[model samples]
Target chain A: MFDDRSPIYRQIADQIKDDVLRGVLAADEQVMSTNQYAAYYRINPATAAKAFQQLVDEGVIYKRRGVGMFVTAGAQARLRDGRRERFFAEVLEPMAAEARALGIAAADIVARIHQLIPGDSR
Target chain B: MITTSALQVRFGDTTALHPLDLDLPGERIYGLLGRNGAGKTTLLSVLAGFRKPSAGAVLFDGAPVFENVRSTSRICLIRDDGMVGDGTDNLRDVLDMAAMLRPAFDSGYAAELLDRFGLTRKQRLGALSRGQRSAFAIVVGLASRAPLTMFDEAHLGMDAANRQLFHDELLRDYLAHPRTFVLSTHLIEEQSPLFEQVLILHEGRLLLQSDLDELRERGVSVTGPAQVVDDFVYGLKVLSERTLGPTKQVTVFGGLDDERRALAGRYALELGPVAVQDLFIHLTGGVP
Candidate 1:
């Protein structure tokens, strides 16, 4: 199911990007056609096509003419770097702010972070 | 392309549809939504050439649709009453008639759909259950492959699972062969996503018509402390509002631009998109 906070096409593009960053969709691998994705998700084909167009515009995927769309070379690494830059502002910042509101100190948050990732140094 | 210009229909003293103008291009599915007795059937019937509009015209590619053989053959309307005729006819007879009358009807596809829906060729129309009758109607609709197909509450008798199956099959066939499909139904939440555009009818008038995505973008819910929520929603068209203790949630109708979103972020407000069904309910005054 998709949420309405943004257009479904934008969400579709984001999901593909996440897959690329996680290496679930390897670079140069053929992606599902717009029709296939539309059928799978029970959405309009045009909506799915819009998502594909956005991904193509971002250089995340490229069309192989009649065959289908394929993940562009280095798409995974590019997505990873972009996500890394956003991780702090989109995830950590709000989380740290929530912790502060709840009277948890920065040191305590750091210690909890360390507890979660035992081998990592902050 | 189907275009209606100032179209209106009246029965005796009651106006079923007020003068309305609409243009529906080919190759896209449209959702026609309205409450009971909202003139949805009247509009579709006019489009299908089953009835003549009292005023203005319903045109298919610049030609009038009413009583025109060329246009009527290309337009298919399947109503909830199962337009397959009386119960005396068997499935085979009905399909045979469809093949004889409908130029685009595919008999092979009809057979495949019958088998998929667990229907038999020898079964009489009267013997099938309500759900099966609905399924058979869908079979006729899809296999007809008419350029402009309209299903007006055709799934009323179907169960939730069967309705979902119908949606899937409709989408699959639509993708395989693109055409114009107008679905008039009360199941807004379940079917709205399948539509590229949606037209809402209220009190025999065209209330709103827009791309589904654009309609979705018009509604948003902002929740935070009462003061902050009030400040953010001020001067905006607020559809509905709720308050619990010191927290408030306001559903507003309009695009949430970046500046307004940033303002919400500054206030730590939780902003979320409103579902199409919820927005519809709010727009229609929660008549249900």
Candidate 2:
């Protein structure tokens, strides 16, 4: 089931992106048809179709004539790169701001990060 | 497409539905929400050709549907009162009648639904429980496969589990065979998510009709420090407000654009989606 934090279509798109990034849905693999997805999720068909259309627009999926949608070639790589670019702004910035509010220094946060991942410096 | 032109239905001295125009294009699901006596059923009855509007016309594809056999055959309306047939008739008898009448009736699908709902064809309608009768009505509605199918609180007597089954089956069938569906119900919270569009009625008048997503975007709750929340909601239509110590939650009726949302984010305000049921109650001034 979906939550109210965002639009359902956006959630659907994000879920598909997550699947692709995790290799659960490999590139060139056919995704469920919009109607199938809608029935499975118990959501409006139009809403599910909108999510598919968004994926299509973002080059994550493509339609073959008279056939269903399939993951675009290199979609996972493109998604990972996009997520990497957003990591600092979307994840780290908020964490850092919260740390500052709690009187935690940036160096201490970095030390904790190093402790969590002993081999990674970046 | 189904369109109504200034449609109004009056019985004796009381007006059931006020003059209003409505357009329902084919191949979509619509949720009709209204308080009791808000004309939801009246509007649906007019659309289904069960009653002729006193002042206006109900048209299907530009032809009047009142008493038109061809048009009525393509439209099906199932109400909560078990309007399909006599109470003594068996389930199999009803299905037989449906197959003879409905041009697109799917007997195999009906049989499947009957089994899924745990309804035996040998059971008499009169002897069945309230929930069983509702399940039978829903089965007929689904298997009828009419171009325009309307269910006016047809699942009222059903238990929660059976109701969920009915919703699942309805969606699956609809996806398999695309058609137009209008569902009028008081259980908006559970079923509103299935609707592509929503029609809200108040006091025999159409309150609003909009895409479900757009309507959801119209109302949002913003929570933060009292002053910041006040400033953010200033000059907006505030539907409800709550305060606890230094924090305040204000529900506003308007779209929040990116700039305003960013502003909320900067202020550390929590913005949450407003439930469609809450919006309906606030809009209609009805008690929850």
Candidate 3:
């Protein structure tokens, strides 16, 4: 189910981060063993193991020796912090640039955002 | 682990493999990619000791492989034609033979796998359909648990659903019992995910070998306005290209550096992942 453009392990790691960020994987929650993930995704167990290793290396998840891995206590916050750090350069700036190229004013974009979120303006 | 030194194979006047040195470390899955006549089968045959090399040595753990029971017993090569069994042999007898031949063979697992593939022990090998024979081949290959197991396209006659089951079982069994697996397949995209490392052969020479991701990074796709794409890819090795109206996409062989990537970003050009299958097609003289 993974593309060959990038390594499948990297994709799996990104998905794990996404799950944590979306609260689908709570802090301290036990995660699927590498075999389970591999079987579910139909990927090589080594690839699945590599993803788990990366997460463990990053302190995004921790292992329990004989038991399975569990999400780090503050992984969601840390993941959100990482995304927030990239929000401007990765997300908002691109949106702003695209809006500018489309001839939409900054104020107009702000108004649209407000309309969608309805008073979340800061 | 298996190693080959100055190994060469010939068929009458045709040279199937050139003098080459190679190593296959144990306990990992490897994908072998090549077009037809790429010497894939020849290479696998030599590894399995089915054919003696015309020149040089094939060794397992430093000992010779040809007629060396120590090495051959630990190596199993299941060819596409299900060469592991005689056509007249009953399914049960075939598995029994395997268990007797291969030291690590597990008959119970073979039975379980046969059931999964919907094959019965009473069927004669000659009476089953092509797909069924392939499924039986897979059963022997996996159940053998050879330290070095090679499946030369295990899904040859199976349908898509059966292929999926094969991949699933391969990975699951690999986790439970790790071993070295070399899978020579033309279905690159469908099967490459199961590979940690990939070996590509062209003609009789080793073209490339690397981690699958690193190999993938060797190629990239650049897409943008036709003019922008042309300008951005001026000096790069373009493998293929397509243009539709104002937009264009060019497949570049070598990857772009960070500076070029940032430059593409400035030009609003999109950098996409080139599928390994596409890379293989272009690398092997596309469409020829």
- Measured against the native two-chain assembly using Cα atoms, what DockQ does each of the candidate structures obtain, in the order listed? 0.69, 0.57, 0.72
Q: Fraction of native Cα contacts kept in each candidate?
A: 0.60, 0.44, 0.73
Please, what is the TM-score per model? 0.96, 0.94, 0.94
Candidate 2: residue A67 lDDT (0-100): 94
What overall lDDT goes with each candidate model? 0.90, 0.90, 0.90
DockQ of 1: 0.69
Q: Write the per-residue lDDT of candidate 3 for residues B144-228, one digit (tens) a residue.
A: 9999999998788899998988998898888889999999999998999889888999999888888887778878899999999
How displaced is residue B87 in candidate 1, in Å?
A: 1.8
Write model 2 residue lDDT over B127-149, tens digit each, in one string.
88888888999999999999999
Off by over 4 Å in 1: none
- Please give, for residues B1-288, the per-residue lDDT of candidate 1 as tens digits: 999999999999999999999989899999999878889999999999999899999999789999999999999999878757679999999999988889999999999989988899999999989889999999999999999999998997888878887899889999988999999988987888789899999889988998888888899999989998998899999999989999999999987899999888888899998888888877877743
Model 2: per-residue lDDT, tens digit, A17-119?
Answer: 9999999999899999998898888889898989999999999999997899999999999999999999999999989889989999888988999999999
Model 1 chain A poorest ten-residue lDDT run: A1-10
The lowest-lDDT stretch of 10 consecutive residues in candidate 1 chain B is B279-288
Flag regions of model 3 displaced more than 4 Å.
A101-108, A119-121, B225-231
Highest TM-score among the candidates is held by which one?
1
**CAPRI rating of model 1:** medium
> A68-90 in candidate 3: lDDT tens per residue?
99999998998889899999999
Any idea what lDDT model 3 has? 0.90
